[model samples]
Target: MRISRLAPEVATSRLIARTSGLLTVMGGLGAIALVLGSAGAMHPGAAALGPVTAGVGLVVMRWGHRIPLSGYRFLMAAGVVDIGVFAYASPTVGAAVAMLSLSAFAAMGSFLFFALPCALGYLAELLVMGAVVVVARGDVDAGVAGVLAVLVVGCAGAMAVVAHRAATAHEDALTGLVNRRGFDEALEAAVRATARTGEPLSAALFDLDHFKAVNDSRGHAAGDEMLRAVAATWTPLLPGTAVLARHGGDEFALLLPGSDGGSALACAEALRAALPHIGTSVGVAELAPGDSPADLMRRADAALYRVKSRGRGRSELDAGGQSPMARDLAAALAAGTSGGLSVHLQPVVTPADGEIVGVEALVRWTHPELGAVPPADFVPVAEREGLIGALGAFVWLAACRDARTLSEATGRSLFLTVNVSGLELDDPGFPDRVLATLAGSGWPAERTVVEVTESLVEAESTRSVHALHVLREHGLRVAIDDFGTGYSALSRLDTLPTDFLKLDNSFVSAITTSTRRARLLRSVMALADALDLILIAEGVETPEQARALASLGCPLAQGYLYGRPRPVAELVASLTAADVVDPPAVALASG
Candidate 1:
């Protein structure tokens, strides 16, 4: 809650919380010994000191929880104290207890940050006690001693199983790809490594094209089948050893290690060509060393939107096939040029009213040589390289700057919504960052929308929901972007903090061809109405598509029909010139 609760401090808090429960039990034992000894019910010697020592452990655990930022360290300290208490109270019993404790420690090893150290401490304690026992008894048995060792090792094995199960609980039941938390962790790790080594890493963020339409026409079973099919298709095409994670619902990411912008692009292209029936919009970015996972994802996602803009089922490389200026921009990003990037906004309009109610802020990189590089090419790299936090901060500043300028120029309270990476939501500093940025920019909080996807909400914790609530508390609105693209349960929708639903474009694209898709759209509209949430239909390419979406009660629309994303000056000019313009002579333009 305090400013000091940032990064390293929070890491400390996590350390303590994890081990506090175990310490509580030990502390109670020590307290009991102290009580009995004082009351003359137990000997005033080391042998009668176990319960009192345990009580002391409980105090440490209690303190650990309160500290909030030193959880891991506190827990490790607790383990050390346990060893000391046991040694003083009763050496023989302490050795046996150490073996039992060691097992529990091993079981929680994977989840605990200090597992190895805790295990070693326990082992050390056991060895010391073992020596003490041999000296006191002068006898070593072949059967009983072996049995004791086996029991201790067995306890450690049991603990390992417990930790493994705990880790797996958050995994996607169908694809074995890292779920939301897992993906966040993997991305964060990549970012940190890239920063440390200055190696280019990338993230490919994509979703199945026309996936919802498949579900609507074939049934939920078929939709699930399609997802599994796509995952199967991509399994091999991904670089032989990359961190591929299912990012909740339909979205998946392939984290490339030591990959350059070009290599990452090649990987995206291969993935795009592998799918036979379904297509995907692939966004790729070369992670800048020192970037946060959130920042990297934002860049990757921005690149993906460029692909979506170019038309789905395609891949956009941050460096390839760009104008000279664009290429220069890519080069500058690779060289770690500061102030080389900026943000642009694409309007989401009401098909019926044609009023610019909201705009999605997209980031763009302007390398000194390349001019302007699309976000898709660089965002993935940022997420993988752990620069996502910096990327998010940059986007926040740009979006706020544009929102203010738009309001001032148009005399309209334009709502500016920005897409956020899942990793951003998991950062404890995210909510605070949002509040501070908004305050600094003097932007109206209600006029700002934070767009998130269903996959992220589903993969993340109740904390994601809580974070959204916190954003709302600070007056910012939240929208579920790319809806119908992920397998979000109805119950989840009921619980998550969402003010709007931005329906995925694929469903809108298929409305004219599939009755099932139309029906699904109708149902979504109905649900939105029931929930009193605004519905923004994306990818409205044709007039017919626009009409169909409006007829189905989708109040807002975005896509080529409205306008392609452009620079601020161009966007302002287009807004001034908007009219009930005739649709393009043709309805559907194939990519």
Candidate 2:
């Protein structure tokens, strides 16, 4: 397939810059105030000290834009110092002493931004105030000073929490990178800045390959660890001027200020090569003068899809910022590309006797323009855009229609299990639609099974759960697909009316080597047996894996070892060649 390049928005750099500026101005002001007030120059003179400190605050805030992080720390220090000086400048002797103490407290609170300097400032201010009182012979109220100091500290503490929350809100909690939301805001600012300065900026999107299978096989916690490891690997390799963030899940976005497509591509290449086992697909696009964030993101995603189409572990530069595949798919859809999407089936056999009991229906898209776009390439985009429901229904109808024709021919009942997406649950008319489709096609509902996953279950709403129960009530079989991968595995098993548990390949992978995995697989098999649920092992890619699973008493198995998924016609031929008798056609749902 001819894949198009991605053009992500240049937004993250502007945001990082803005945040650095704010922190610098605030930090510097606190630091300067603490130093001046401690020297006794900014002390009792409200007249001279007030304007001088305010001027210093303004300068620090302004300089922050030029040297963000350094300026932020400097201003923050100044702000803390000025707070203390403002406290000591009170009219009465007792109030001045109290204000000095308040200054010390404020300095202590500023430690959130500048720990060592602020701490030293706090002690120095207290000592200076004590010395002033001793030398001047003025009445000093240590009690009032102590009370005011504590109050200032409390206020500073509250402000610190607010600042921290604001920072965290823009960051991806999982990887400490700027999140998509933060990236968007930054991109806009960068666009404006670039327009004014006439400098180029670039954005890139990276996606991990086979991430879902990894999550399903290893647990979400391990997946999270993998994500963090990837982030850690890439973060330091980025140029100091770059802004990077974990956009969400297995995706990440990088914004580079003053960088062109070539530079961005180089950086992406470096990051692509850093990971150990997993590969990454990077889509990058430099900002064109007036492009919108949405347009850039689309370009980047398209480019990413292009990279993925060619197979991952490569960086693709999108100078034109066009996702040809996505654009082609869109055009095809508009031009009635209904024929482009169709189901392919793979056989699942009883491991005990190598007898075919059923086939799993998978969808394929052969775009008229893009040509044979991989399912992984387009499926996520479909799901994200809510097109999966329509696609799912189409596949269901076709699979059921095929099953109905096959069932009546053989006299032996053949079961067809269709993959159900998370979207189907909330599909208001989903259950009724399935039932109606079955009735229209004269297909038996009992012969069809809807395979859903625990991840999909998490995506379901309460209404979807009700809809699922309704489907179950109508005599349709429901199997929890990819069992043991989701966080809510045990809970879903205990609650949802599931008839089969499809073990993810990760457990099967270890069964051949590790005793622990073998033991765990045994327990899972035992649990399924105890529950009287059918067990199907997924991803039995090798004969060895298939044999090991069968030895563990897993009745059903599916993977490339038996036969890879192919078009319906091809799948049927393979099954016939394997000597499985075709069942007589039996009517089932339309989809």
Displacement of the residue 554 alpha carbon in candidate 2, Å: 32
lDDT of each: 0.64, 0.66
Residue-level lDDT tens digits of model 2 in 1-591: 001001012112233334434443443454445545463443345435545654554554454335444444454455445544554454456445534544543343343343344444644554554455434544655565456546555655664555456556777888878888888887877777788899988899888876876877899999999988988888888887688888877888999989898988998888887875887888888776557765566556656655664556788876563255545544445444364877777777777556666778888888765588898888666544334556666777777777765555434466778887555565557899889888888777787788887776644334456777898789887878888887766755766767778888888877888999989989988888777778889888877787788788887888888778777666555555666554333233322
| TM-scores of the models, in the order given | 0.45, 0.47
Could you give me the TM-score of model 1 versus the true structure? Answer: 0.45
RMSD of each: 14.3, 14.2
Candidate 2 has an lDDT of 0.66
In candidate 1, position 111 carries an lDDT of 24
Residue 26, model 1: lDDT of: 47
Relative to the true structure, candidate 2 reaches a TM of: 0.47
1-591 per-residue lDDT for model 1 (tens digits): 111211212223334443544544544454444444343332345443455445545664566446543454444455545444443343244343433344334233322333444544655555455445534544445455556556655665565455446556546778765677767776776676677777778878876765655765889898787777777787877666487777866678778978887888887787777875677878887766445676567667656655654456788754423344434444544454275776677877877756676678888777555566567867755554445677788789778877788667665556788999766775667999988899999897867888997666555443466788899887787888888876643557776777888888989989989999999999988888788677788888998998887677677789988777766777766665663333221100110
lDDT of 2 at 544: 76
